[model samples]
Target: MSNVILMIFTGLSVGAVYFLLGSGLALIFGLMRVLTFAHGAYLTACAYAGWFILRHSSLAAGPSIGTLLLALLVGVVVGGALAFLTERVLLRALYQRDHLDQLLVTAGLGFSLVALLNGIWGPDSRAVPTPPWFTRTTTDIFGAHIARGDFVLIGVAVLLLIALEAFLKHTRHGLVVRAGVENREMVRALGIDVRRSFTLIFTVGGAVAGLGGVLAALYANAVNTTIGDTYLLYAFIVLVVGGLGSLRGAAIAALAVGLLQQFANFYVNPGLGEILSFILMGAMLLLRPEGVGGKKIRLI
Candidate 1:
């Protein structure tokens, strides 16, 4: 029972990061119709940024809660800035073009960003330095030790879910974003600036991804150039299963995927976690019964 509890926490911890990526991807594709390949790059860059702050900066001597907060803030800012540039400079012109063109452009940008990361940080993994509190388990329940870091990931993800839901459902800006997703031209005709909403949503997606990147490093106990790549595809699976433009689904699916992967890997084969996740995704697609192209612009 204790072993099982530990696995559950571990799975939830992994899923929390995936939720950040999945939710961000769903929100972006939901509103902008742009499946950003560069999102993983955002995660990677932000992780690097966070790592530098925590390890190479003035805080490196005696990192604490304040240091962690600062690192997370830097990561979020970096992610937002990168996303703003992508939306304004590269994606704005191609929104009206064929989806293939947009896909190619984003894909190319993602590759370039990865190359830049490799150039700056090199290909080696950097050790993530955590505060002592993070490593110390708060308590051992039935011999299942629960680390403080796990709670941090889980809590942040839950809070983010609530905040975004409130933002989209309650505020005027949320209304604009929802309307913009449904029909940008109609919103534009109403004299609402849908482009700003586009940029806003995209920036939010990037910002969330950036936050995830830092938390992910903390979760894994290390950082690497390919850290974002590690979670990117699985997150897309979560996005697809949850449905595009649906934060509700993404939230639920993230927990489900994370739990499934963790349990499967432990009780079954060592690498069966991802295989089972794909099976779950397939099951979801079968139930939806949508055409491939339709799925691209699908809101559900």
Candidate 2:
């Protein structure tokens, strides 16, 4: 029973990471209808940036809450800035183009960024230093041994999910963004600047991806060049299963995949967990092509 609980906790933690990454991808897809291949690079960049700050700055010699928060802040800011720049420079021209053009351009940018990362960080993986509070293996809470980081991740995920849903449903900016997502022409008709709306959405997506990168690095204790590509694939699957533009679906689907993957890894084999994820994705695609809450939209 304890083992089962442990797996569930671990799975939820992993799912939190996936949710953060997938939420950003889903947001971009929902609003911009752009399959943002460059998003992976954004994640990688934030991870590296945060890691570098933590390792090289005056905070390098010690682990403290200030260092942790500052590192995450650096990651989020850098990620948002990178995404904003990419949209303004590389992607603005292609917004009106076909999906093929968007894909090609973003994919090219992703590859370029990956190459750039190699040049700058080299091929070696980098580890993030967490605060002393997070390093403990377990904390005694009501007589149950639980991993400190796992439940923290889950709690963070839950809070983020609620905050996001509330923001989209309640706030004026959120309503405008949602309106833009449903109909840009109508939004423009209302005198809202659709381009600016898109910029805001893209920037938010980048921030979410950045947060996920920081969490993943902390959880795994390392970040590498290929992390973006690898997690991007997983994010795609999660988005497909959860439905595009649906945060609730993403949350549910993330937990499902995370649980399944963890269970398979424990009961079956390590590699088999990845295989199972794809198998689940394939089944979802076959049985419900539109995904859980996703509407059917033509992807050309």
Candidate 2 residue lDDT tens string, 1-300: 767777888888889989988988888886578778888888888888877776765354675677778878888898888888878887888887888888888899889988999998898987777766675778654444676778777887898889878977897778888888778888899899878868887888888888888777878878889888888888888898888788888888899989999999998888788898899889888888777766543476
lDDT of 1 at 281: 83
> Lowest summed-lDDT stretch of 10 residues in model 2?
139-148
Backbone clash total for model 2 is 0
For model 1, state the Cα shift of residue 31 in Å: 2.0
39-95: candidate 1 lDDT, tens digit per residue:
898999999899888886544477788999999999999999999999999999988
Task: Kindly provide the TM-score of model 2 when superposed on the true structure, using C-alpha atoms.
Answer: 0.94
Best by TM-score: 1
List per-prediction Cα lDDT, in the order shown.
Answer: 0.86, 0.82
